[model samples]
Target chain A: MPIYGVALLAGCTLVGLFVGDLIGAAMGLEANVGGVGIAMLLLLALTNLPGRDVGPASPSGAGVQFWSLMYIPIIVAMAAKQNVAAAVSGGAMAITAGTLAVLAGFALVPLLSHLARGGGQRGERRDD
Target chain B: MIDVARFADANGLLVAFVFVGLVMLVSAVLARQVGRGRVHASAIAIALGLVLAWAAGVDTGGKNGVADYPLLAGVGVLGGAMFRDFAIVATAFGARVTDLRAAGLAGALSILIGVVLSFAAGAAVAIGFGVTDPAEIATIGAGAATYIVGPVTGASLGVSSSIISLSIAAGLVKAVLVMVATPLIARRIGLDNPASAMVYGGLMGTTSGVTGGLAATDPKLVPYGAMTSTFYTGLGCLMAPSVLYLVVKALV
Candidate 1:
């Protein structure tokens, strides 16, 4: 069931958060560092175990799959949690930074695609 | 009659879930009927959420937006850091190793390049805006990587809440723009194939935006794009608050 997935995710999250805190402490920082990222790595590793039937097709995997796609709601919730008026009134910097960053990212897409084309073509041939 | 207000207060999280569901339902309809599928429903939902939060802030004169209302008090917890992190981590479950292999080295490089370039652009803008603190700058730059990364980095760095909010706003803008722009420029960018799609996903780094944009461009490419994009967020989360923060500190 999806609950099992949630259980697995919860375990990963706790372990991840603990490790993140340890890392932060080691770095002389006061916060949990990369806890969510660590949890994701754990989940990815667990779900992709070799010769395991725990892939998305399995029951627990179904739970994992369901929550994985449910990120939209979570994202929306996160957005809603923000104080937009405060952020906007604070300065033009946020918008400016965001827009420029996106533009920069967009500009690089073509270059990366071109660079990847040769390698991607070889991979495609091997797969075929 | 039932004491509805008290009941809502008691079930705030449930109410918040129901309320967000309604908003999403409406957003999906709007995306189809008004946006004509060019825009992703999640983008519209985010926009709507921001507007509602703004309205709630103005109406109640409170900091937590709609959560200030007793009936929606659960929004505070529902949208809290705990659930946010849980959701983000769970997204990794959808990624497949085979998909990553198909995209090759370019796919991996694109993610690193995308994260660094986006972070640098954001940090530069923050510096231009006269932000002197490295932590704040790194947090904002991480937000440029993705919304999830921004807050995670901010919380890790112990930056102010307002700064974290700004970071999220920055990421949101990127996601919306990416969703709207992908189809319009797909052909010109040669995003017709799965390999290119994966690279595009790595570059964009917003799973929802990449998936939505690719779905509009070609449904067959969504899986490929989403896989790398998922990795993008993970990489951003891992790097932003640690290595990137130190780098910003050194420079500043």
Candidate 2:
């Protein structure tokens, strides 16, 4: 968790990413595999912390701030490097698709899931 | 034409998501022990998450214009200091919400829902723009994994850490136009659990993703488990590819 180590990890992640990109050119699977590896690494970073609270949940607002602040430079750098206006042109439509899907999930999925359990509930009643 | 480490950067949101989750989860225990004082674990989690982000450079570079390094892994261990019984009233009874199993189930369900949607949004951008950059792929992959990692890691490492950046600006833009905004889709809908709310992910994907890390360690929220597993993931998967397509389209 030291700064030096964090630097080292970030560097390694970039190196790994670069290597994977290059390798992916020859064989399409490299990026896919490496990407998954990266995903796993991210998952491993925080969620793996040991301890479980099966209680009412709460999260710190400050934690979200520091993390976002730290990472903003990276995003801005990416945007600034590009034709920012161009890249953002269709960003709205894309987000729209996702928004729709989520809404559908809440509206339709919840109802369907409940209906699926209708028989399950009846069976439970019989057992009771 | 040159792609940055976009995937790696995006995937990095996992750390932030999990770390928030760990802090909240720990506080949940404390909430029980201290008799319900700091139950705003989300508030505490946001604070701690921001600190972790700063420590890791998960967000903007410091005034020095360099990335920050991530730490706070050890800080997560303090979660154990809190050990107390928690009480959860069923948000809704019967089949709709799976019987409340663990606080984590709620987080996980929400996290998974958030991830799947993010993936879709990314895919849509990709397809809409025809982007096949390694950076974009990496970004989408990271998005997919961010939500589910906390449960995976919490088994060993302890509390979640920090994963962040990217979505804040986008969220800000959306916040400005909530009525016409994509994230506002949640607002259009009626009452429900706000944890898995898409707007939360949009405005604060990093925070929600990091907090969502609780899915792994805590008992699956059996009551809402149906929504968590089937709905969140089901919809999440469906949405990711489309979003990816959109990302590609935008880039192209």
TM-score each candidate: 0.93, 0.35
Instruction: Give the range of the ten consecutive residues with the poorest summed lDDT in model 2 chain A.
Output: A75-84
| Leading candidate by DockQ | 1
Candidate 1 residue runs with Cα over 4 Å from true position: A119-128, B1-4
Estimate, for each residue in B74-128, the C-alpha lDDT of model 2 and write its tens digit: 2222221110000000110111222222324334445454555545453444345
Q: Can you give the lDDT of residue A82 in candidate 2?
A: 21
The TM-score leader among the candidates is 1
- For residue A7, give model 2's deviation from the true position in Å: 4.0
Give a tens-digit lDDT track for model 1, residues B1-252.
Answer: 998889998988888889889889999999999998878888899878777877887788777767777888777787888888888888888887677777799899999988998899888988888889999999999988887789889888888767888888788888877888888888877788877888889988988788988887899999989989989999999999999999999999
| CAPRI grade, predicted model 2 | incorrect
The global C-alpha lDDT for each of the candidates, from Candidate 1 onward, is 0.83, 0.31
Measured against the true two-chain complex, the DockQ scores of the candidates, in the order shown, are: 0.63, 0.06
